[model samples]
Target: MSELSLKVLAAGSLRAVWQPLMTSFTLQSGIEVDTRFGPAGLLRESIEQGERPDLFASANIAHPQRLKALGLASRVEVFTRNRLCLTARKELLAAQPSWLALLGNRALKVGTSTPLADPSGDYTWQLFDTLERHHAGLGEYLQQSSLKLVGGPASQSVPNGELAAAWLIRGGQCDLFVGYASYARRLRLCKDLAVIDIPENYNIQADYAFAQCYEAANPLSDFLLSTAAQEILFREGFARNL
Candidate 1:
């Protein structure tokens, strides 16, 4: 039988989870997969611009739903869940970090993904909105204070598939980054980085969704939702969809 070749455009944050799964899938199915990793919104734009990949895996449900609305995808399915967290240099924070204090501190540089271009950014905005309910004007303050470091019109280019949040902190571009908890865990492996969990009340769940852009069925899509795949996602710090 001829080997099958498939194209997959996935969220950049899925690198840690997807790479191993893809390798296992190729070995078992004799499929050759070509993958592109980036901010979900940017990849969605590419698809709208006529780039057709076999599958689209987004960091949030909204992006895949947008594709479904545009007739680019037949359906959207929730694959995994994530939560927002704060990532910063260990030396930049006190012994016990508080989200409120960190965000309200004007002297510390805060970074977030570009809103509308990355679901992480969208979730961060949602978090800000939630914060507004607790403290008047705080939401606007955070929005204005945060540096849009990735996944936007003017985002800086990152090399070697490094995440924008990690790159920014490593280069001293920003003192802290608000991003996915899974990403924070990945970064926490670095000696100098600390991952702080957001309070439950302020945390926004990031629901990842995926769709097959083309009519053809891809086994990998089904595989992603299987028990084996969910296990990998869980091990990588993603919360499984119940």
Candidate 2:
């Protein structure tokens, strides 16, 4: 039997989880997987420009829908959910961090996936906006500050989970890195970094979705939405449905 080779363009936050998966999938099906990691938006742009890939998985369902609308993708399906989490140096959390505590610090510095390039960032922006409505004065500081947080998070694509965690543990730089709870958990950075839950009223849930591109040549695209794929996502801390 001939081995299948598929290209999987996935979210930047998935670096930790996706690493150990490709080889295992290949061993099971004799499929050779080529993975490209990036902010979800960048990946969508690549697909639009005709970089043929067998499968597309995004941290948000909207991108897959955009691809489907562009006729570059088909069989789009939502298979997972993720929520925002805050990463802080262990000492910071030990101080008893809270939503109110975030702004009071005066020392609080924050980082998130790039909103222009990633959905997680976009959601963070909405989170801030909702916070502003409730707190009023607090959002003013963000507006006046350099952060000027317009639409969302950032996407330095921090190399890997360990490095991102290191950023927090070492402190002095971005004091908080807000992103997928799963990534924060995977890094175990929360062991030293704290997770400030976004209040349910303001917090947003991320719906992850996947689709087969029109130019794809294999069935792995279909396999991605199967019960098997849901199992993998579920095990990884992503809810199978929103």
Candidate 3:
């Protein structure tokens, strides 16, 4: 273990790839990283409340930009990108004529993370907006009906190593969940669940951004933008920031 250390606060969606990424970083730079993962918006609230980590990575650019605006951070960079996806029970998917029709079904429960507290929820809302633009009134209907299942301050904690979407669906909490496409690979492994891709026309691109909260994070920050790190992100289902 290195005496030189860095503290990182990252979005929960990064949890799958973060360990390997940091391990590589530590091997190359001899700096140990202590990281915490959570909803990006709630993580930002902690920063605003004086929980200063050396680095802060968010699922959306807005939170990091807010930190920069408040002078709590510097050098906001879009590190990677993701897209919104819908995960539903396999049976439910087969019964519906289309994914959009599945969502439009009044009796089916729709689950989403809490908006303003989690970027996934915000992106899901954006998807709803796109749906409404094409279908009229659909966005309002979803916004009004979607259950705020997780990612809020009051939301239940998902068990370690369990995908929330899978857990929720298996528990019969919701018929479907709107979340990040990065988890599609893992979610697909669940026998009873199906991952549905949001069309390019209706999908929202989620920009994952990071900022340097302290000078100690500079090396890691620079490394994140380097080819080595970008390649790792690419393999982990994230698209590089072009």
The numbered model that scores best in TM-score is 3
Candidate that beats the other on lDDT, 1 or 2, i.e. the better one: 1
Q: How well is each residue in 12-80 modelled by candidate 2, as lDDT tens digits?
A: 666655655565556667778778877788788888888877788898888899988988886787767
Clashing residue pair totals per candidate (backbone < 3 A)? 0, 10, 0
- Candidate 2 TM-score, true structure as reference: 0.82
Task: State the lDDT of candidate 3 residue by residue for 122-189, as single tens digits.
Answer: 99998998899999988899999999999999999999989999999888899999999899988988
The TM-scores, one per candidate, come to 0.92, 0.82, 0.97
Over 111-201, each residue of candidate 1 has an lDDT whose tens digit, in order, gives 9998888888999999999988998888889888888888786777777757667789889889889989887666877888888889898
Which stretches of model 1 miss by more than 4 angstroms? 1-3, 161-163
Order the numbered candidates by lDDT, best leading: 3, 1, 2
How far in Å is the alpha carbon of 234 misplaced in model 1?
Answer: 1.0
lDDT (Cα, 0-100) at 194 in candidate 1: 81
Q: Estimate candidate 3's RMSD in Å.
A: 1.4
Look at candidate 3 and tell me the lDDT of residue 229: 89
Candidate 1: give the clashing pairs.
Answer: none
List the pairs of residues colliding in candidate 2: 90-192, 112-154, 113-153, 113-154, 114-153, 114-154, 114-155, 115-153, 121-152, 121-153
Best by lDDT: 3
